[model samples]
Target: MALRANRVRLGIFFVLIMGIFITGIFWVAGGFSSPVTTSYACYFGWSVGGLNVGSTVEYNGVPVGSVSAIEIAPDGRLVKVVLNLEDDKFRVDDTIVASLFFTGITGLQDINLESLPDSVERLWSEDQLTFESDMPVVPVRSGTVQSVASGLNAVFQSMAQVDMKELNDQTIRALTRMNDLLDSVENDSVAVRLSRTIDNFDAVLVTYNDLGNELTAAIRDAREDAEPIVEDLKEFTGELDNLSEQLNMMGADLHNTFNVTNSILQEIRELLPNVNRLLDGFSGGYRGEEIWQ
Candidate 1:
């Protein structure tokens, strides 16, 4: 009976140990003591490549939550992802945005939460309105990979629209025309004509230089010949100035002589009047003496 009791005790102990081990597993799996999480919806206009449920959600490179669900909106134009983030880990407002980025070189993608400046306006989409969840929507922006992929897509589309055959035909025609022009030039001896033209131009330049030198020499000789004539003209001007001074002195002497002659004529006229009076007195005395006799 003691052996049976010992066996039963051992079984109970084993059951308790198993129960504890299961509880530990459940706890580790987050079946118990689940953290308080806040739900948010993210809308991406681009392909969500490599993103799946349970993908890590990060805020500025720190893991803060996980992707709970991914689905296409009813409009079928945008992808909607549900993110479960730890409560109070960060704030979500109009300034908060979500983006998809590769986790590493593995090509696996995850959602990254980032803050925009307060001055940035919130972007809204028609697809976002279709979401029935009351969770605050976090607008999605293109990451580096998405932007690069978009650029490559545009390039491919542009290439697809190009008329390559026509372009090649035009290029061939241009090359043919160029070759024909070269052949014509070669056949016409254009190089020889060009060389002759250049030689003629050089000859003309040399002639022009010789003419210029002759003109310069003639000008110098004319200037030298004119120097003696300019000196003669200067001497003539000086002689004219001396003649003018001498003429002025002669005119002054003539004026003085005319004044002296006028004074002598006045004295002579006075003496003649006195002499006429003396003669009249003598004639009266001679007549009175004749009467006395």
Candidate 2:
């Protein structure tokens, strides 16, 4: 019984050791405290050559998640990559863009997420998905390689659409016309004519300047000649003012003479009336004397 008890106790100790070893492994492997992650899907129209499962997903260059799965879409026209991202690290919306980027020269590629400017309008609601998938779909943009390739393709297509032969003919005709115009100008002595015209214009300008100076001088001389006339006019006006004063004095003297003559005439008229009355009285006396005689 003692040996059996020892075995049981030893077995229990062994079981406890194994439990602790498992727990330590789980802790080291991050199984005990796994972060809460959300799944998001991205559909790429072009090739995803270097991207694979377990590839890093970066938000503005910071790793925030890892690719969980990669497969072809149901339509078989696109590659769908699923990302398991830590929750609350960043918000996912229509304005967020996912693009592939080469991590190194070894051709390893990763998905990078970036948000557009805040002023950009959100095209879809948060709950809306572009593809019929359980995970929310993040819009995928062309990678650098794909963008370069697309630009080259477009350039080639545009070149192919151009009428090169006609363009070349037009260009040749333009060059020929330009050369003919140069030859015509040279043969017609256009440069010499232009020089002669410029010289004539300069001569005319000089002549106009001389005429302006002469006109200014003539105006100054005329003004000087009129100065004596203006002074004579001032003297004539002063003489007229003196004559008017003399006329006013003569008028005052004539008015005084008229007043004196009227006063003398009035006295003489009064005396004449008295004399007539005296004569009448004297005549009446003479008549009485004659009657008496």
Candidate 3:
């Protein structure tokens, strides 16, 4: 009875220990507790090489959940991942977004939730998004490989639209025109014509300088000659003024002489009548009254 009791107690102890161990294992495997969780789906058009189930999902670097499932959609065109967040109280409108991020040197990829600007706030659906939501799936971006491929595709597309042949022809024409200009500059006749033009310009300058000096000398000589001429003219004007005063005095003298001559002529006319009467009186006294009459 004592041995059986001891054996039963040991069995119970073993069973209890195993149960605790199993419960711990299930908890670590995300199966032990049923917490209120919200599930979200994100799809990557690029390959999800380093991503898998149970990978972590972080919101701005704070761990919120782990991946619940990873599968291709019905279209088989993208790798769709379902993330079950332990915390469901936070808001994740269009102001939030998800992307694929790598962790450590092993190249393991996870989903990263980040904030977006308010530009597209209204674009977010009023309803909260869930793994079962049937609306249009918002696009998610992947790092290195997708970006590099997209960049190359853009570059090739841009290159495809370029007109290489036309560009080459234009370059050749420009080179030809440049060569012709250089050749013309190097020609002997062009060089001779340039030198002659320079010589003509120099001669013209020398002629202008000589003509300026001659004009200056002529102006100085003309000024010197005009000074004596101006003085002579001044003296001649003074002499003419004196001669005019003398002519005025001579004209007054001639007027007085003409008045005296007219008085003498009047006196002679009166004396001649008186002398004729005197001669008649002498003849009357010498001969008689009849001879005097």
Q: Which candidate has the top score in lDDT?
A: 2
**In model 1, which range of ten residues has the least summed lDDT?**
284-293
How close is every model to the real structure, measured as TM-score?
A: 0.47, 0.54, 0.45
Q: After superposition, which runs of candidate 3 have C-alpha atoms over 4 Å from their true positions?
A: 1-35, 88-90, 118-139, 142-144, 179-293
Model 1 stretches with alpha carbons more than 4 Å out: 17-31, 118-134, 153-293
**For candidate 2, what is the TM-score?**
0.54
How displaced is residue 263 in candidate 3, in Å? 99
- Candidate 2 lDDT by residue in tens digits, 1-293: 99999999999999999999999999999997878899988877676898889999999998899999999877676678899999868667757978889999999899999887755322222243344676687866566786566555655555665556765665565556546545544343544544554565565566556555655655567766866555555655665565566556556555654654565565556455544543444332111112112
10 residues in a row with least lDDT, candidate 2 = 284-293
Q: Tell me the tens digit of each residue's lDDT in model 1 across 1-293.
A: 99999999999999999999999999889897777898988876666889999999999999899999999866687678999999867667766878788888988999998888865433333343655645678876667765565555555555555555765565565556546545544343544544554565565566556555655665567766866555555654665565565556545444544554455455555445544543443332111112112
Clash pairs, model 2 backbone: none
lDDT of model number 2: 0.67
lDDT of 3 by residue, 175-248 (tens): 56546554544344444544655565565566556555655665567766766555555655655565565556
How well does candidate 1 score on lDDT at residue 121? Answer: 35
By TM-score, the candidates rank as: 2, 1, 3
